[model samples]
Target: MKFSRFAILYVSFSLAVALLALGLQHFLETVPVLSPHFWLLFAVIFLLTGLAYGLSDIGIRKGGQVSILSLMGGLFLKLLISLVVIAVLIIKFPENKLLTAINFFSLYFLFTLFEVICLLRNLRDQNQT
Candidate 1:
């Protein structure tokens, strides 16, 4: 499926970024929490973003009347879900709230960037055809 290709690309990109961040952190001897948990969190975020984008693409391709509402709604839902998950994680680990929030925002921004780019590209293609 198209989502599978997108997922693979996103996963690779996310993983590479995470690795680079962790390596830099280690080399500079800064943060200590760039652990497996951080890696897994971003990986899941990437997957979720890709899945949402794929669904949006499918809807646009299938529904002749698809509108900007679809794009906005998808983004809203994804942001809501991500925020809720982050809230729960923060609540469960209050001691590391700052780090958790930073990591969450970083992942959120990265995924959002990818999501918006894909949506725009798809919209452009649709408009062309």
Candidate 2:
């Protein structure tokens, strides 16, 4: 879980997701399943996840209870920011609220799961050392 390693892995994951989303959008061109602002959502989630990971990684290096607190704090901040972004998007563009929310949440969950998995692996490694 070095920051560099995490950055590489996260960027790769984000790119993969972006490609999948683009493909899906292309496939469903006639339908409006995904919002036009899908790329915006992707960028927001990607930056948030990276920022959270960096903060948590720094805390992990410091050790002790700080690590746990940092991880929790990062998760909370990410969730809060994501909610705000989604709410604004929904309110501002009320045309495809449901579809946009669904797409946004799916990306959010996927990114969150990836971060959690990486963080857990980092914690396990820290314990082993």
Candidate 3:
């Protein structure tokens, strides 16, 4: 029943991002035509997600019984995957500046996935080897 430091950090970052995004959402709503609270909220989420996942991946890859370089590579792959998802979404549902919302969510999901996959792969490699 011991908790991992990475897990604690991830949860803390997620909550902090949520709170910050909520505050920013309020601020965005107060603006004029540039008011895009939804997009702003998502932008914060994506940025935080990338930071948390990338750092976590780096730590695990470096000594989790797997190749550390792969962990570093996962960050780029995750970014690419996020961009592709955003592109596909934009093509499927054309929106104005609000498109940032989709991009944010896509990146968040992709980054989180990359972190998880890296950890799992490391575990698998360790067990197999």
The regions of model 1 sitting more than 4 angstroms off are 1-5, 33-37
Identify the candidate with maximal TM-score: 2
lDDT at position 64, candidate 3: 52
Candidate 3, lDDT over the whole model: 0.55
lDDT tens digits, residues 1-129, model 2?
A: 787888889989998998898888789989876787888998999999988988888888899999989999999999999999999999999988988999999999999999999999899999999
For candidate 2, list the clashing residue pairs, or say none: none
Q: In candidate 3, what are the lDDT values of residues 26-97, reduced to their tens digit?
A: 688754322234454446545655564555455554565434655556566656655575566556656554
Q: Residue 75 lDDT in model 2?
A: 94
lDDT of each: 0.72, 0.91, 0.55
What are the models' TM-scores?
A: 0.81, 0.96, 0.50
Residue-by-residue lDDT tens digits, candidate 1, 9-126:
7777777877887777779775555533576567667766866786677777765656555676678778888888778777776776777777778888987887788677777877
lDDT, candidate 3, residue 58?
A: 56
Candidate 1 least-lDDT 10 residues: 31-40
Order of all candidates by lDDT, from best down to worst?
A: 2, 1, 3
